[model samples]
Target: MSVGTIVAVCVGNGGVPKHPVAEAKVGPDGLEGDRHRYHLHGGRDRALCLLSVDEVRSLEADGVRVAGPGAFGENLLIDGLDFSALRAGDRLLVRADDTPIELELFDVREPCATLRRIDRRFPDLMLGRSGFMARVLGEGTLRAELAIERP
Candidate 1:
């Protein structure tokens, strides 16, 4: 049981610099308050995006300053888990209420053109640190301080 903490819950209408919310409703498609501008960005396989705080720290160590929670277009900011240990198709269960919200980890998210706003080399610099895309398997309320596990 690789348990991690939800550092933040973020949402965006269409782009980067997503705003962090105290809590949000997770649905089969994605988080209730979120939406994507591009079609390729959203769907069952890529319903939500996740970012590892460890990765953010790595970037910060390299002098990269993340604007905030949604700067990377991630819906969730997680901490205390080795992202490399998780593989595609792996399921993440977030503890909440009576049931755990399930999320299917997809492949690493491809750095998009929007990231250029941060730095031209951001795409390349964040190669392995960009984090993974995910599909919601079980819907539930998401908020900070929640426990998420790779089970």
Candidate 2:
């Protein structure tokens, strides 16, 4: 079985030092409501960000917060699993607490120069195909301890 983990989640318009707090929400056309959604390969108007679980683990160990560069806002940062395996329409069975919540992999979340700007090491970290985007099948608080184990 492929194992995955939830790195972190942020809600707000362009998660910066000061911004109105909000929850990560998904809607049609891949718009994250008032948030921006992007693709891992090359797409626009979607609120998605992808990073390997290994990278997330490293960040957590260092006690660092993965914030967007100035204005770009991302919701969830995941780690550990092979992102390329997740294709559009693939359903991710994420275990949320006692309940098994589902998120549909809707698109490929490619990287951008802004990502490099946010984390100077991002260019090295997300060297290959790093992450992708998905739509929430169920609404809930995507906490840090939560796991994205593939079933």
Candidate 3:
């Protein structure tokens, strides 16, 4: 079964240096108050970005200094899911108080030059591991440690 737990939730106003937040509202337009470069990020199909904690650990082990959560520009940092197993059209359900927030994975995120600025090796280290993008199918409050399951 595909399952994971949100280790962290991050957001940024419009650029790099996305910081972690305790909770946030996720909607069709994406996380509340979150913004993107527009030219290469943030659209319906690319509403939310996710990266696995495992991926971060791997990068750290490789000596790439990722600042912290949101370092890769992911809105959600999850643990225990094999990101490689996910493909376009895969659905993820995040258990919330009233109802689950559903997300549809659609594409792999490409590392941008901003990453290189963080660490000259970041771009290459995240070549195929940057993360994946998704669209919000259902809106709900998202928090860290929420259980994520594939249905």
Candidate 4:
């Protein structure tokens, strides 16, 4: 069982650019209990970016740093989790209290020079060497304690 921690949480809309600054979402737009939502690639959709806790360390070590979820334009900054291992069409069980948001891994986020511009250390960040991305299969409350069931 791979364990991880949420270093930070962020949310934003489709207006700001160049590190839009993360925010916390309140009310029930599907998110639970004051959960913040981050907008990625414009307001085309929700569920922005994700990162592994281990990835956080990788970035920190490199000098390039990010807060968590939307910190560096990523919606989710997970710790000690491997995003690559979860492929497209894979169902991820996001558990929190009695609420569990089922997330489906959609695609492999490829690396780009832009990431390097944001943080020179990004190019080497966990999948940063390969780039990172994620698609939410379902929207709901996702607490710190949760696990993904391999489908």
Per residue, candidate 3 scores C-alpha lDDT tens digits across 1-151 of 7889998889998767788999999999899989987656898999999999988988888887878898878899999988889888999999988799999998988877777777887677788788899999988999998999887
How well does each candidate superpose onto the true structure, as a TM-score? 0.96, 0.58, 0.95, 0.59
Q: Per-residue alpha-carbon lDDT of model 4 for 60-138, expressed as tens digits?
A: 6777645434545455556655655755566555554465555555555544445665566544553543324444544
Model number with the top TM-score: 1
> Could you tally the backbone clashes for each prediction?
0, 13, 0, 18
lDDT string, candidate 1, 1-151, tens digits = 7999999999988988799999999978999989998998888899889999998988889888789888889999999877989888899999987878999987889888888788777788888899899999887899999999997
lDDT of each: 0.89, 0.51, 0.87, 0.46
- Candidate 3 stretches with Cα past 4 Å from truth are none
lDDT, candidate 2, 1-151, per-residue tens: 6667765555543332212223333332332434333233223324344446554445545544554321224455566666656677777766676666667676665545655555666545544444556665655444554678656
Estimate candidate 2's alpha-carbon lDDT, on a 0 to 1 scale: 0.51
Which residue pairs in model 1 clash with each other? Answer: none
What ranking emerges by TM-score with the best candidate at the front? 1, 3, 4, 2
Off by over 4 Å in 1: none
Candidate 2 deviant stretches above 4 angstroms? 15-34, 37-48, 55-74, 119-127
lDDT (C-alpha) at residue 97 in model 3: 85
